[model samples]
Target: MDADLPPLTEALVQDVIYAWCSSAKHEITVPNCGAVWGPEADVVSVTRARLGHEFEIKVSRSDWLSELRQIRGDRRCAKWYRAHTLTNAKEEAKKTAGLAAKGSNCCGLVPPSYFWLVTAPGIVRDDELPAYAGLMEVVPYRHGIHQAHGYRVTETRPAPRLHRVKLLDNQLMAMARGVTLRYWQQRRKAA
Candidate 1:
């Protein structure tokens, strides 16, 4: 019944993210771009030239804080950051409040060439992001009988080619799974 429509959830945030990626310029976007048991971001895009983009979508404050805390407390994430850095990953290694950006850095896996924070419109302040990171807003609405999706790019930049190729290769080998499972994988991988 129409009255029983699902409530807005992180799934919606992921859907909005996927839509944005599909329409994004000159990049191939994939949702759940990690293995069935790996840390995955809500969205990952790879440019034709092989640049990697990572996006974190927070539908709730809890989700946002959880991501932040994971970045700050996870030793394995720090280890991955160190490992990727030795390979000369393209992204910069920033130390934010003693938490390394690359240790975020994926919060668990390899950091993308570019990392972005996306949230529902009016949810975050631009000043909260690192200078290199971008912020985006996703707004979904229903117009009478038709539903349309829209997004606002408050700030953004291009992805990195070499890193993107690596992301695509990694996702290709990942076992297919549902979004919920993949999301939990990210949480678990962070710990």
Candidate 2:
């Protein structure tokens, strides 16, 4: 690392992602919600049940490997689909449940939903990444000195499903709490 260079921070990567996604019209405005769900992911943005995206920030290869281990080990993330049991569809629900409960890599859900790996620009090329992974590049500058912008996303997968994520436990509560807390906090500050 050069003395003039700045270390890439997770926050910077996330900020750029937030801006980029919003600019591109993604429904998820918040970042890092998936962290509380299972293993602490860098960012997981969900737009109701229609779409979901996961962002993994990696400043270095080691950082990338480490965070990946957490997700890999967290068996809870293996299942992202749910069973839909509508009236007159008991048989379908049963079958969906059976498939959902199946082991990982079961095609339980339609994928290509962008799992973004935001890293230092040019750190990892797009061709080098997994087919399912979309790459977002960031450049970190000194705190409050250099701003992160012009981020690029390449080879991104579009995640579309009736159920983007299956609520594992109280993750929904946490998200709600975050929304309420932020609302009040901002209101109080303005008040």
Off by over 4 Å in 1: 1-7, 25-27, 36-38, 73-110, 140-191
TM-score of 1: 0.54
Clash numbers, per candidate: 7, 1
**lDDT at 127, model 1:** 52
In the range 1-191, model 2's lDDT, one tens digit per residue, is 33454455777677777766665666555555533334345675655453446677777877665545544453444322211111112343244445656643432222213456778766665555544456666643334422444333333433222232343224445555666776898899999
Candidate 2, residue 62: how far the Cα is off, in Å: 2.3
* Whole-model lDDT values for every prediction: 0.50, 0.50
Off by over 4 Å in 2: 1-7, 34-37, 47-49, 67-112, 125-128, 139-174, 182-191
lDDT of 2 at 183: 84
What is the C-alpha RMSD, rounded to one decimal, of candidate 1? 9.9
